[model samples]
Target: MRYFILFLCCFFSYSLQAQAPHGAIRGIWVTAQDSVLDSKTNIQKAVENCKKAGINNIYVSTWNRGRTLYPSAIMMERFGVAIDPRFGKRDPLKELVEAAHAEKIKVHAWFEYGFASAQGDSGAYLLKKYPYYAAIGPDGKGIEKNGLTWMNAFHPLVQNFVKSLVLEVVKRYDLDGIQGDNRLTAAPSLAGYDAYTLAEYKKEHGRLAPPINHLDSNWIQWRAHRLNKFGKDLYQSVKAAKPNVLVSMAPNVYPSSLQEYLQDWPSWLREGYVDYVVVQLYSYKLDEYEKILKETIQQVGSKKGQLYAGVLIGLEDGYRAKPELLKGMLELNQKYDLPGELFFYHAALPKSGKMLKR
Candidate 1:
């Protein structure tokens, strides 16, 4: 009887351990537009929903569209607007940090817009005030690609401005991490024709002008290197401010992330600039998701432990990932031994929650 009882206890313990999710950082992004941040009550509800869903981390958008979700002395000093006017003196980040921490959820301040200024507003308010920050294209106009207008990410002043925003959040908030998406250290591949960039290129290359072809191999490498350097600097700056806070990045998948947007995240990982990378592996198809997941695993090599898959759960256009597909993706993550996953937004948690429990 004693031996039989021991066997049963061991079997149940093994089963329970097997049922738990595979990673340390099961997370979700809470965007500024999400109603979860609309009030303290909503935030509490969101945190409870996350707890039930098995989400342990929340990436809250702090910066977007030339403004912050929290009151900012930086933006006030520069633009005279402390926070996004829509919230009216309420600091959603403060409320969210308190609410999420109460639930034992780690919060990361996400800089959603990064160096890009506006989506379709041509440079928006930031560039309207600081025209020199514009990331000029070969056409001698501000770079606009895929509806997002650019800032000169390679320029020193722009880099410092972005650094200041990140450091301010690190200093002000009691948070677990800080994050930047694809737009953070990345610029449209066609950018860098601005006068400042051109002058620097000329100075470096025996006083020669940059090639007219934006896709020139040498040009691509040079721009990617600049962005990579900025990423390292930004990572160091964040560490200097808060040694314990994780510096997370969610750049798009590699190779293309370099060839298209100049993100160079593999270098960021190899150099230890990012504590972990949540590669945006947003795919609606199961086979495609697996394909990319495999490729990502192979590319990261030994750094798999520092990787998290960023799944697309919902979109603003009312598209939700099918439950079975979400389940299959989680299974794939477990099969591949990826450390964790972060879904795109908060509203989709209930669907993922059900899938996670099952």
Candidate 2:
């Protein structure tokens, strides 16, 4: 009886260790939009909560709503304030890095807004400063969708401007890595019809840009190719400036992300542009979530720990995911052989119950 009990303990321990290998990227995202980062005490409590939840990485927001969370020289020179006014002169990014590092957690500056100008600035500071830089749709209006305004990715000046924002963070902060998502390095498939982008396209292809039909296959591929080139350039730039700093991307699911947002992340991984790719598989149903997990495994083959799952813990719309759902998602990751995951936001973590311990 004693030998059987000992064997069972050893077997379970071995299984647990095998399921969770060393150096797995167990991360969670903390956005500036969260009120918890508004002060030093709140930020410390947030970091401590994550540490207690066994989070080892944090992807904090550096850019959002046409402002920066840190003291950005670029924004100060171009716009007015160096940091987001909601933060009240507090360097939340710096505080987050210090707090996370003290807890031995990795920090990545998530350029959440990337090339985006604003959601609806309505003649606000940034829009007033660079009105010409915003992207245009086929309707001859500013490219606005879901209330978000994006910058033209094909424009040389816009590309340089976005790069400067990212480089500023890398150079100014003691970060382990930098990241971009659907909003940063991407434009809507219906975008690129701006006067400048069209002129540039005509100059290269000897024709005006296509019409507003986003389903046009050739047009979609052409725009995606341009973004792909930008991705490669941005990747190289990040590495060139800081060779050891990791460059990561968390884009939406593939093919669909390409069709809608022109984010061909699998190709970026293949082209060696990203050090890590966190695929957003936010699903409410277990079967649907498991299906995406399988697809992620097939897509990220042989990369082995380079791809992490972006789990949706809670959303801003007051949607709190059940604890059982969260646990099942983690189990699916283990079954599919993925190493780790990053919850959408730290505030989504359960209040009292233990979650993600192993």
Candidate 2 weakest ten by summed lDDT: 14-23
- Specify the highest-TM-score model's number: 1
lDDT by residue (tens digit), candidate 2, 1-358: 9999999999977865554433488888888668667889988888888888888888988888888888888878877688877777678888888998999989999998887777776325665677778787888877776788777877888899889999988888899999898876788887888888787678877686575786688888888899999889999999999998888888888777888898878888778888878889999988899988888778766664677889988888978778788889889888877778888987776562267665
Worst 10 residues of 1 by lDDT: 15-24
Top candidate (lDDT):
1
Cα lDDT computed for each candidate against the true fold = 0.88, 0.81
How many angstroms is residue 135 displaced in model 2 relative to the true structure, after the best TM-score fit? 0.8
Name the regions of candidate 1 deviating beyond 4 angstroms: 1-23
Candidate 1 matches the true fold with a TM-score of: 0.92
